[model samples]
Target: MQASPIYIPSESMDADAYQQPMPQTANTPSLENPEDSVDDSTSRESWRDNKKPRQKALYLDNDSAPEHRLSHTLQLVEELIKEKEILEANKELIRCVALTRIIYGDGHWRLAQSYANLAHGYLTLRGLPAQAAQHAESAKEILLNGLDMSKSDEEKQAILGTLVTLYYTLGAAHLIQNNGRESLHNLQKVEKILEELQTLDGGKAVVLKISEKDLALALGRASVLQNKLNSAASYFEKVIDYVIMTEGDSTPELVTIYQEMAKAEQSRSKHDRAIEHLLQAHSIAIALYNKASVEAAEAGLLLAKAYAVSGNYDDAAEMYFAESLRAYQAALGPDESETLNTLVEYSKWLVQIGRNQEAYKLMNSTCSSHLKTSGDFSETVAEVFHLMGTICLAESKMQKAYKLLKKCLEIQTAVYGSQHKKTRQTQELLNMLQKSPTTSEGNKTR
Candidate 1:
């Protein structure tokens, strides 16, 4: 975890720093056209006299060449995709698809590439899994329909590259759509082809540019969707091994591997192992970022949750949770609103286990922080205060509970008028507190 900055930076300065313009692109020089060459059969001297020098120069400088225009236009989509501007990339992709279809018709390889790109765009951006599947299927079907069965192995392998990308996209889309069976089917097909290529290339299939790591990652995700946890773990283990061998711990892939592995462990109720994996992810995240980072806090939050659900109510478990909470705070900073999300999850788990004292203490801390950060009238502050008031009433602190509850009611009424659901709920809490602030029974402990 990183030390919090002693001083705060101005938000406007940060915004200005982030708005720097992109660098300009350099122009490609014109190339000579071989088709415009002088006939050697008519001797060099004869052609040199007949062929106008201007004609040769004009051919070499043909800026409107079809191949050049196609390449330049296609590059626009590629660059946008790299920048993660999916909407802009999709627009460029549509233009390329239309141009390619006009130039070489529907079944052409170039047109198929554009379709595959459109699928990629849809898959990366949420709310379009069906569209992603549509384009992926179109690319695969077009390639299979156009290519001859009798084509050479080299030619087939070349086309299969595109098919491999299409298959991966199709599998990802199916997974997103919760069609696990279909997702697994596509992933299996990709794995088979990759295995065959590995053998044929004598283990030098890096030329294919698709590593075993990539295939394993896809298969692992598919297996997870199918509820095949054991198989998914094995696949993820392979991917983890590959990432460690090639990229080491500093890369983001290593962090993701640890996170997913932790999830698998958590599913099996292997809390100790899950905690270990989450810690590993957290340590790696610390190296990747200098300060409070979303990824690091996520790892810490997962660790805290693991401790809570590990079915232990001992002092050790309590201490572990406390440390995990500190890590969350350290990685997420003092008062980022997102901190509430993790705190809420942890508090709910505490309430589930009947650890009311710990839950109350946590709620108190959260409410204090919320009050300090954005003050009394905020919705989050009111919510935390309401929780604190409920806990106080349970603990039989009548006066304390009444004060906290009334404060929460006032905040809600001010922000959301008395007719609003939240305001009404707060009013109900206040009414209940007034009617019975101190209960006959004492709070129960786990």
Candidate 2:
């Protein structure tokens, strides 16, 4: 029996071949007019000069043969997807379902495959989980019926490939919708079918479209949603191992995996293990991209936060915080939101560790920068004023505290209005500062 033509790998097919005109034969209709055909004796150079390149038609008329329409639409889908026109490709996929039904009737496995492909496209390209699940359920019903009627081994294998894709689509859609139990159930079905394929192939590795690493990651995420931390950690570990084997340990791909593993460890209350994973990710990011790169800055910030959360505030947290701030400043200039935000976080950390003098200086500089870049009425400038005022209050600098708090209140009133919670809080602080004993002493001296 001939192998199923259910799927053709787009990469393996020559795009140029599809662009060329099909050869005219008794069975194949010619798109060109016979009167327009040039004489056979015409010079090749003249023919080349006179002939215009035919524009590729995107859609065929309903009168065209269903097989021809299907082939053309499939090629169009491949070209659209390659060009990253995912929305157009998805529309073509919907058309493919109709064409497949026209050619092979309702019960054929190819129709099921078309629905499965549409479901995958909906989920991955458009992020429409409900639509994806609806289409996938349709594919599942058809596949179950096809499986019952299948007689040949090739047919069974072909149906199984579509089933694998269908289940994966359903699993991913459910996962996105936060239906963890349903997601895991569909993903486990995919796993079972994969194992069955492997067994059928005599234990050789079965080459499915979905990679082992992606499958493991999806399962890990689903496990996490289910609060199965141990299972999630194991699956994430498998992903890390697979990635290291395939892409090397120092690849940037490992950074996200390490961070995910760290989160899982943190959820399990294993702070030390979480720190270790974060450090690994931070180091890898710094090595792969320079310390001044945004990637490194983000990784450093996460590592710094992890250190702070673990109470390693004295040296390690401070060092990483400073590193992150410097990196953010270098990658995105000092006036950028990321740089200012990192400065605020690091200043807060400094204050937490009783480095009040340093925190005050940083906040003082940030206040000036924020005022210059964002204006005095901006929330960021208001925040800088508030922090500086609180730092002054802590150190008994009542005069400076009163000045900063007054400025904070002014900005808060302008930006958030007097009735807002932040504005009211700033107003209360200013009132308290006015009633301080030091303020009374300073007033008497003046």
Candidate 3:
């Protein structure tokens, strides 16, 4: 929940860095139509080499029976993810996209939802940045175009809900790109759409019970990006307000809301308030761990951080390490980046607590694994290197430290201009290294 200072080493990193993947929508409410199979072979033949033809009625819902198979596809994706089979989950999402593209042409709401969901799948599972951005953009295009169509209030609300997803997805992508301004723009658009939806016919009653919760999420994220910590806290509080008013305290939704509130309060430096919320989140997670590992891990992480800040370092460290390990195990194998990131964070905490040797070993393993999976200059790779450099410096491995630090600086300079905060920090570190007693008089290598 506490965003790390290890941002991308690029000017755009500030813009794109916060672009965490949007959560996938569940049990997508279908428009009134019967479900049918998408003729994949026919679709491939018909559109294989051809471009999508623009239809005059872009918003027209298919009068033909809608594919009932889609509902099952979503269920399968959820199941796959729950089982920690992310690769399979990703495959299912891609199938959904290919099949949906055939059944619902480009620019259709259903197609857009498919794209949005696919983006989330990529983000949560593989951290496929480019794929995530492409799908998000596709979803945005479809939802924006659909808004002009003649639809009922209910239908319009449904469309808006999808649009919210699209905007948030784009926002997240931009955040990762270090394009903070663009991310903020997309997030504000989501906020605007949600504001309108909330006023429509006594709330558009989104099929996803978490629609407003997501809206609050967008606002909280945007506020954080803008450095409006108090505002972020208020937005997260709104999630609690909306859920308590609608679903009451007993729902799983309350658990999620409380955790988010804890994060927002922590960001705002309200440690006591954050601790209170996290305790509630932890209690719920303990009760519901068998039902949802995702929620359980989330609550555990929040509680861990809260405990750490409250001077319960021993317990906090244990919880942090344990939660990180749990997340790694739930990643359905070693290919998931989010799981790796969690591990990296845990290792950083270990180092902070004077467990330098353990931290070094973990960082070494993490760096090697990241290099093998992520390209040489990936954000994650850069972060791994930076952490390694920090460890080496701690151990006074001057040459090794300089080599790693220089590489980290180079990556940051390349991705985020020399003027960027990350790049600047790396440069400062390099300068300090040059002036160290270990360095020769002619130390101008960096």
Off by over 4 Å in 1: 1-68, 71-92, 121-131, 144-147, 177-181, 196-211, 287-295, 313-317, 327-333, 345-362, 372-383, 402-446
Which scores higher on lDDT, 1 or 2?
A: 2
Model 3, stretches more than 4 Å misplaced? 1-252, 267-269, 282-295, 332-335, 372-376, 417-421, 424-446
TM-scores for every candidate against the unseen true structure: 0.67, 0.76, 0.44
- Model 3, position 143: C-alpha lDDT score: 71
Candidate 2, superposed: residue stretches over 4 Å from native: 1-62, 106-108, 141-150, 177-182, 201-207, 376-382, 402-446
Q: What is candidate 1's CA lDDT for residue 153?
A: 54
What is the C-alpha lDDT profile of model 2 across 13-81, one tens digit per residue? 111211223232342111122112222234123423433343145455658898998898788777767
lDDT of 1: 0.62
Using TM-score as the measure, the top candidate is: 2
Candidate 1: TM-score?
A: 0.67
Cα miss at 325, model 2 (Å)? 0.7
1 or 3, which is superior by lDDT? 3
Q: Write the per-residue lDDT of candidate 3 for residues 88-188, one digit (tens) a residue.
A: 56755766776586677766788888877777555546555556777778777777673564677777777776676667667766665556677778878
Alpha carbon lDDT at 437, candidate 3: 73
CA lDDT of every candidate: 0.62, 0.73, 0.63
- Itemize residue pairs with steric clashes in candidate 2: none
